[model samples]
Target chain A: MNEVIELLQSHRSIRKFTDQKIPRDLFLELIRAGQSAATSNHVQAYSIIHVRNQANREKIAELAGGQKYIADCSDFLVFCGDMKRPTDSAERAGADVIRGMTEQFLVASVDTALMAQNVVIAAESAGLGICYIGGIRNNPAEISELLKLPEHVFPVFGLCLGYPDQDPNVKPRLPVESILKEDYYREDEAMVDGFDETMRDYYGQRTGGTKDTNWSKQLSPLFNAKLRPHMREFLVKRGFELK
Target chain B: MNEVIELLQSHRSIRKFTDQKIPRDLFLELIRAGQSAATSNHVQAYSIIHVRNQANREKIAELAGGQKYIADCSDFLVFCGDMKRPTDSAERAGADVIRGMTEQFLVASVDTALMAQNVVIAAESAGLGICYIGGIRNNPAEISELLKLPEHVFPVFGLCLGYPDQDPNVKPRLPVESILKEDYYREDEAMVDGFDETMRDYYGQRTGGTKDTNWSKQLSPLFNAKLRPHMREFLVKRGFELK
Candidate 1:
């Protein structure tokens, strides 16, 4: 396989890692990759905080739903969808920066997320492992305060990066046709068929037999979960008026 | 700089292009990079529709807010947030999949965006040019029907890709400190100095000393424009009940 193909096919989330520090150059390269990502209107509404202090990492791990991997990883980064940059810029220019809506908030989140994925790819190419910690969003205000975020900025997620101690199996994806469409958006029945086979095979390998769990079984309940119920209201409370 | 680093540092959204088709292998590699991106719970709730037909590209270009470059590009891909894959799996297992709510929808949208950015990176590394078209969301329902999307799958954005015929200047980014936080989020005067200098120099080079815009001047009007004002209701209407 070519380097990109190998990178794609062999990729897996690494929650466990060996105790080794990431080289500074590789870290810089990863951030450079992230910064290079395309931003909405080229505004680049995002920021990253790298935490190397053990005490800080431990606190972040506890804050991130008690995920131990956060502290265990060699490097931890918190990605924030930031509006403060522009807000600050407005002050410098003597202009008003008005933002109290979902579109702007989502733009920042989307921008940060887009950049984070680039960081993930760059880190992987450098032989590093990464696990995204969405748990960081569970307590956005606390995480923001803990990270000392200014107003108009919110933390979207955190990433734990390090050298892998174990090689996890590559996660199976829905078939190419399921995701790749033609000229128009055609909802082909073949998509379900092909993806069902992939999921079945993936589950079979994971359980050494056909498991009752499938993609839907795992996904449906996640939406019904209590913690995620008031996310819209939470966004509103966090200054994103979903108009 | 390494090839990847150069790609990262020199990224520009090419809104103009010459008539040249991207090679199939290079196209596939870009898709592979899209697949390698992290997904929430590995659900991979996204789809890419590659449009090669000139007539179709022309129509899509028209629908994408009158962007002529889209019609001129050799290939166009519409990245979509798809919830049907898991919903179908749930139905096959006789489970309720309607739990696909707003948060889930956002997850899919974020997931697709992350993947799309990688596609852009890979394309750029191979000497291809790309520009994201968010105007697709301006009329989601019409675009959805045109793309033959089933329920619960919404059009997120469009990407125009082809070989580059122009070398756009590197866009300036806010200084590292502006977004980079220490232990916690600290918003003070310190984040502004270096960035202002960096961006002023950048703008001076790009646009003569006469008409230079800083980050704030570029972004504040977007909020005032009330773009995608009804995106929330539109999303709900499109099958994502933000429960």
Candidate 2:
């Protein structure tokens, strides 16, 4: 395998970080790399908010379910799905643009994720550790207000970037057979069963045999309750009406 | 800049491809690299359907706004955002799993995009070309039936991967200052105006001076009318109620 593929395959989310801060130039380069990601119709409907203020970062950390890494990381960034720019630009170009549509939300969200993945890859290549903070969505409204995000824009997720201070084992994934199908959507109970065992072993080993749960069991909280149920209204209030 | 950054910055969507089929092993490796992408809460809620049947691919091409590249590429894949498997597994593992929620939809969508971006990077590193086909959403219900997608599982986008037979110029993006903000969101009308000119030049040069429109003008159709207005109802019908 080549270095790029190897780098991708050896991926792991880093939580703990050292005291080293990224050089300003390198950080800018990482954002440049992010901007290079494939955008649908070249709309580029995304923005990154660098959270530099200590007070704001701490507030964000609390909002994101107490993910202290947001405060501790050398740099924390909130990636937002933006639709205002394109719509406003189109209106300026003489088009009576519609404000909210389902496709617009999908485009902006997917575009943001694609760009952030490129940033993650670039940071890891430079021997930096990074973690995606989806917890930011737990309180999107507060985070948006804290970052002064305008209407037609919403914070999709946060990312923590810094030098590594702790080494975590690469997390296991579902088996290849479970995820890849030939020509149709096929269900393989055997593959799922096999993967559950693998995850069971992984969780046990990772937590020193103290955690006795498989992937499915771990996903209970996410599925058992209404997960961030306010997101629909929040997104609509942020101007992604999903119309 | 390193090879990864270079590879990312040099990305262009390739629609024309050679007839050489990707070896099965290499194809599997690409998917493996995709799985290495960071997923939300280890949900890994995505599936890739490899459409090898010529008839199905042609039909998909028809469904996707006659993008012939769908049928022409060496391999065509439909990337799906799947909440079914996780919810089912979790329910079976003794959780009273809820069916559809907005957060679930967002997580699955973001997870699928992150994984697909990794596949794109891995493919490009191996000298392969890829084009993301969002047009599949034009007939998502038909496409879902064609692929036999279950409830809580929907195709986000299609990908055409193969050896390139055409070299397209890398598309330009908006200026860094416009997309990156320190501490809070900011707007720069001048940056957008400047980028419109850059895009106008790019389109003119790439199309041999036939295309006269700039980026803002090009986005007119997307916003002037209700583009893909059926997507919201479609997602609801597909069990992503966005509730």
Candidate 3:
């Protein structure tokens, strides 16, 4: 396998970081790499807010379910799904633009994600470590206000970037058969069962046999209760009416 | 810059492809690389349907706004945001799982995009070309039935992968100052105006001086009217109620 593929395959989310900070030039280069990602219709409906203030970073960390890494990381970034800039530009070009639609939300969110993935890949390639902080959604409104995000824009997720101080194992994924269908969707109970066992072993080994749960059991918290119930209202208030 | 950064910076959507077919092993490797992408909570809530049947490919091509590249590419994949498997597995593992919520929808969609971007990077590194088809939303209900997608699972986007027969110029993006904000969000009207001029020149040059419209003008169609109005209902029917 080539270096790029190898780098991709060896991916892991890094939480603990050293004191080293990324150079300004290199950080800008990483954002440039992110911009090179494929955007739907070239709309580029996304933005990244670098949380440079220590007080703001700490506040954000608290808001994001106490993910202290947000405060500790060398750099913290909040990636926002932005539709305002494009729509406003279109309006200036003489189009009576509709403000919010379901597709707009999907496009902006997907656009943000695609670009962020490119940033992650670029960071990893430069021997940096990274972790995705989806906990930002736990308190989206506060995060948005703190970031000064305007209407028609919402914070999708946060990312922590720094040099690694701890190395975590690459997490296991569901088997190929379970995810890759031939032409249509097909249920694979057997493969799911097999993967559960694989994950059971992985968690046991990774956690020194203390945490004994499979992938399925582990997902209970995410689904047993309504997750981030405020997201719909938050998104709508942010101008993603989903109409 | 490193090879990975260079590969990322040089990305261009290739709509024309050679007759060369990707080997099965290499394609599987690409999917494996996709699996390595970071998923929200390790939910891995995504699936990929490889549409190899010519008739199905052609139908999907028509469904996706007559993008002939869907039919012409050596391999076409429909990336799905699947919440069914994980929910089912979690239920089977003794959790009373909720069916649909806005967060679930966001997670599934973002998960699919993250995985797909990795596949794109891996494919490009191997000298392959890819185009993401968001037009699938135009007829999502029909496409879902055609692919036999179950409830709690929906097609996010389609990807056309193949060896390139045409070399398109890399599309330009908005200036970094506009997209990357420091500490808080800041508007960059000047940057946007400058980018419009850049896009005007790009469109003219790429189309041999026939296309004179800038980025803002090109976005008129997307915002001037209700876009894919059926998507909200279609997603609701597919069990992503966005509640």
Q: What is the C-alpha lDDT of each candidate?
A: 0.74, 0.93, 0.93
- TM-score-wise, the better of 1 and 3 is 3
Task: Decide which is better by DockQ, 2 or 3.
Answer: 3
- Per-prediction DockQ scores? 0.53, 0.86, 0.88
The pairs that clash in candidate 3 are none
Candidate 3: regions farther than 4 A off: none
In every candidate, how many clashes are there?
7, 0, 0
Candidate 2 lDDT over B106-137, as tens digits, reads 99999999999999999999999999999999
TM-score of the A chain in model 3: 0.99
> Can you write out model 2's per-residue Cα lDDT over A1-243, one digit (the tens) per residue?
889899999999999999999999999989999999989888899989999999999999999999998999999999999998899899999999997788899999999999999999999999999999999988888899999999999999999999999888788888898999999998866787888899989988878999998888999988989999989999999888889
Candidate 2: C-alpha RMSD after superposition: 0.9
Candidate of highest lDDT: 3
Residue-level lDDT of model 1, residues A1-243, one tens digit each, is 355445655678899999889887777778887887788787678888887678878888887789999999988999887776765666566655566555676678778888888788778877889999978767666777777776677777899999999887877766666677777666656666665677767887888895856565666555434335556665666566666
lDDT of 3 at B55: 98
Query: Candidate 1, residue A206: CA error in Å?
Result: 3.3
Predicted chain A of candidate 1: TM-score: 0.89
Return the candidate ranking by TM-score, descending: 3, 2, 1
**Tens-place lDDT digits, model 3, residues A1-243:** 778999999999999999999999989989999999999888999999999999999999999999999999999999999999999989999999997798899999999999999999999999999999999999999999999999999999999999999988898888887899999999977898999899999989988999989988999888999999999999999989999
